[model samples]
Target: MRNTLIGNGVIIQHGGADYYNANIIRRAINNVRSGCFPSHLYPKECADFVTALAKEHNAALNGDYDRYVFTTYDKASLKDFKSRYDRKHKHSPEEIGFEDYFLLFELIHNKLGVKNPERFEHSVVLRRMFLDSVFNQGKIETINERFSDGFVKWLENNDYIFTTNYDSNLDVVTRLPVHHLHGSFNTLSEIYDPNSFRNQLKDDLLDGEEVDLNYPHLYSTCLVSYVGDLKSFSMTQSSLANIGMKKFVKGYQDSPDIRNQIDEWDESNVLVKRLKEAIRLKSERPELQHSEQYPHKELNDISGALEIIGLSPNNDGHLFTQILENENITEIVFNYFSHQEEADAKRLFGSKNISTRDVREFWLDVDNK
Candidate 1:
């Protein structure tokens, strides 16, 4: 029988939950509290928005709400806010909405040039230091090397690979095609410029214009939204920008400069267009639609069994459901980290036509054999 391997963020030892919480989320909180960006570089409106956002996030981190607070708001608060937002706007709270404020800050920073380029350069260096502390290393690299070596050999011998991670560790370790469902950090620099929007937004008259949206990364746009179990919103870039403007900008939508910038970004944004097309296709063909691009379609087209590693079905219920219902998938192996995860996998995929094993145990068995 044929087989396909799927992976998620947990596969990246040092770059998983721990790294994100420490380097990205914690760093953001600390930066906001300490005023990492100079006041001179911030316009009054942008400064006020960041200050308010940071304050709210600080309150949430202090444990003001009972539920896992991934961001500045407690889960309960987020749910309520989402409910109100959906009812008022006639749309659901998307996963991308959570990161809108952060993206807005990045956009504003680019719009207003840095007051001191030297200081900004120093800050970038310092920021990289923090990221490196979590990402660069001995043990993590060793594990990644081993996993990639084994996994790539298996894929080349048979089947395909799909992952829902943002890192390029898999790409670096193997020459084989490993599809990244989520945007990757490696492509971030190519798609976005923190200092200016010239490369991404500006149209070159000499060059034949083509918006390459496929394999689009995070840095491509200020508006980013992800659809999940909750009611999905229109994934178009313009729609998302409107949602963001309403949520973050308050009365600034009337500003010509802000409107023009958003419009330019929307026109050039390949990711947004891609997502919109996916949404359209999903609507037209729900049963066959697996995910935005490759994950869903490829999984459905698989002629054999599937092996899942480190992916939680909570955020990807639709994809999981599709896999279970696909007649082409004759068997499934779930490699989980914990008993609870195993239980959850069983609950989702069921006992029949499915097998469960700890990730470590599975790897050890593979190595020993």
Candidate 2:
């Protein structure tokens, strides 16, 4: 058995699931209807704006022309929104999101000759709404003790573990050097904290611009994007760093106090320091190093086979492509949720270096073995 790569489906299958994105949308709509902000930390202005937006959204959903503003609003932009959504998701805009609602508000507000669309454009209210919703809805108190213990032991035996999950369930269960491909909630917490080194640098750098102490989640996304871009640049000779830098600069451009935070972060951040060390190790020992930046690097570095648990290949084509192309990956054991998923995995990876088993059965076998 080779080192395994676990995905979000593993956590979900293990009873550590959270509310789906659809549920998030519904929760936000419900919150708006109730005239309440998801978090009590939000201001009255934000609450009122969101509530009003929700009323319009509800009306649109119900095709209530008298209540909805679609007819009088920017029809072109609304059509564009629908087209874009359909193209990206292969779904209709009728099933929109919190972000989409904000976009609609911007379109309608612009049409109504609202002089300052910035009120909706740069508002941190939507970001806060999402942060609060996910934080509240995705709380994982505990995992099955037997399963947790068994999984931890399995992780201990593995050479490396890579995950795309943002939750802290794995962190609570194991002390292994599990690389989080997607940003984690823990990272968000660090970025949001006023006392954190990153935030401290921001505070010192922004001259007199008042920091919104209540809405730290808004900045967390930006910081996460920055780190992700930095990591991508380090792994590949991509211009993602430049793009990320531009975003970082734009995010704090108004404040003159701290313009060098991004440049300074490389030297000051403990995580960045560790990442640099990992890069150095990779340079020194090509065979031994497992990259924290690129998931493909770790997959390619594996000397043995690869085991994929609770990941659908269809949703992760990039990762699947890497796995299929990497000659070092001698075999692949994929855990499937259903027959269709199993068939999809087989079709993607082929029968030569691949096998499939039910996720539940796979876990039970692993625990017993």
Candidate 3:
């Protein structure tokens, strides 16, 4: 029956029903706060405080974290938002975000504060992590089943699939291509592979600064560490309203734009170099441009009935703009779980005459009941 699910061509966007994912500001607190610094970082209390703080910023929004970022990004733009994040810690940006609230509440401020002489030139040591989970690979099967075999076959058959996910777990049954809009690992390995966090841990996080908490047991293994570590790869400062941030490893001078000052092995720098390498290899050979499958083109051309699973609109404004304004998209589907999410989707789609449906969840027995 799902073969009939789409009467037209469909474009898929991966949302939070993901292998390892977090959406709201409270749920994501543990990632940025990390066991790395907070010795006493536990769920019940931290969650209570974050949930309360999120409520204070916008009572109507409750604890919907995206509400903060979406408004901030809509005003400042991601690039400007990121470029000005260091300023958000001390002076407020034109638009405030969740990160600003953290500073406003004095939860994340350090000893140096805004007075550091080099603060003007230094950027936060942003991190991108893909946590390896024993449960990650198995979710692909559940996802495929929830999506339905008929639906999966259609995506595979037409080469119409694109994911923000950095993993190729869909290849278990897929033959064609699954475009990775965000970055992916340069190697061929399951995301659930043990080495993901283990390789990252060896990179060094110790700086001279004092940490909020210290738990040595968390450092002993990849499994425990993964639980207390960062999982998101793309929450940048631009969406953060210039909020203050913590660095992964300490010693640094000069901006990322300054190549001479950057360490060759720095993790954040490495992500930058990968993109540069990708561009450099593709740039010299103009002939390959024609043959290369540009993900942007796929996005620009996204038509038919659009099914948005769990894709967050925070960091991916460019892609959302294309689809949001695309006249060719006849219908839209939001696989949302709560009344809050359904209302959020309606607001997101505002004034679009095209029919949009909100289904509760893919895994639920009754999708829309």
Candidate 4:
């Protein structure tokens, strides 16, 4: 069987609230709220925090207060941090949007730059944003190229299978057996270019672009329409309509068998058949399949050597844990970036044999190290 290596929040420069980036912001807020400095301290304290954070994250901190609210903390220095968050946080609820939240996170990251056990609650929000494609991860096409090369390289060099709770951008480029555990981001609304899905878009896809392989089918200029005039819109028409329909249906739901059949709908779904096909396709490629079963085939031989990174082993996800436990598979590798994360994962999965690593080192190649 071939080995498997997985990475989350490693290659991407940004991540959710639990992410290394956003947590910096969370830490700063917690620090200020917890008396890291006296309440009477000068706003310069905020500046200092931002500068320290910039140095720690290696992000350049730039932009005035107004602009800072919308910026993702990329690479800012102390000077940069001060310039951004030295203002008051007195905006009304009306001024707050996704961008405000993103910027507020940036402020927090800049402020908590040096505090120990940095809290990036913003990064947690950021992670959820990514999951939901809130701000769409800035400059879609360029990011996609960056991510694609990284993913393909990992798949080709590392003899491993990857399971992503996110979508499957890797499958399109690397053609590896990527199991999209929650579906992908490949959709028409995810790109900046109008003709993203067309072959023409591939011309723009350089060696490491961050394509939204799951959110939308492809990157196109039309995706910008999805974020059109956020202020005027309470919720996207499509999303609101779906929500209304869901409420209506759930209020008067059907039976389990009907739902099961609906879930098993043909052509669009193709789960059981897809797994069967994937198994058949790999039968001839034992070296690649790693002896794991297809969807229908029993995954009995798989020792359940689950390598979890950038995820909470919460009760909501207990079903996945149960899958492994029921199979008597014990070997596991759980990696986390912070003290809080470590404590959380430990509480859920226990301290036994769970190796912890910083977010920075979580995805590094062991062989290379």
- Which one is best on TM-score? 2
Model 1: per-residue lDDT, tens digit, 1-369?
Answer: 555555544445434554443344444334445665333322224324434444443233343433333343224334533442322233211221333333222323333443455444433333332333233322233445545355556555555666655455566666667665443444433224332222323344214433333322322221122233221221123245435434323322446675454444552566654434333333344332221322345666776778887676444554676677688787788888888888878888784488888888866655554
Q: TM-score of every model? A: 0.49, 0.55, 0.40, 0.35
lDDT of 4: 0.39
Write out the backbone clash pairs for model 2: 205-257, 205-258, 207-257
lDDT rank order: 2, 1, 4, 3
Please report, in order, the local distance difference test score of every candidate based on alpha carbons.
Answer: 0.45, 0.54, 0.36, 0.39
Comparison by TM-score, 1 against 4, better one:
1
lDDT by residue (tens digit), candidate 4, 1-369: 332434444334434443333543444344445554323312224534443433323222233333333322233222433343423443322222223344345555445462423443334323332233322333322333544345456555533455432344455556766543322344233223333221122233333445444433223211111111321122133344335434433433445664455445464553444433333333333222211111212223345455655554532242244434534445556667677777777666662445566655644553233
Weakest ten-residue segment in model 1 by summed lDDT: 87-96
Best of the two (2, 3) by lDDT: 2
How would you encode candidate 3's per-residue C-alpha lDDT over 132-174 as one tens digit per residue? 2212322333343344465455455442566554434454456
Q: Which has the higher TM-score value, candidate number 3 or candidate number 4?
A: 3
Top lDDT: which candidate number? 2
Residue range 95-162, candidate 2, lDDT tens digits: 55555566546544644556533563335556566556555544532443435456777777878777
Model 1 whole-model lDDT (C-alpha atoms): 0.45
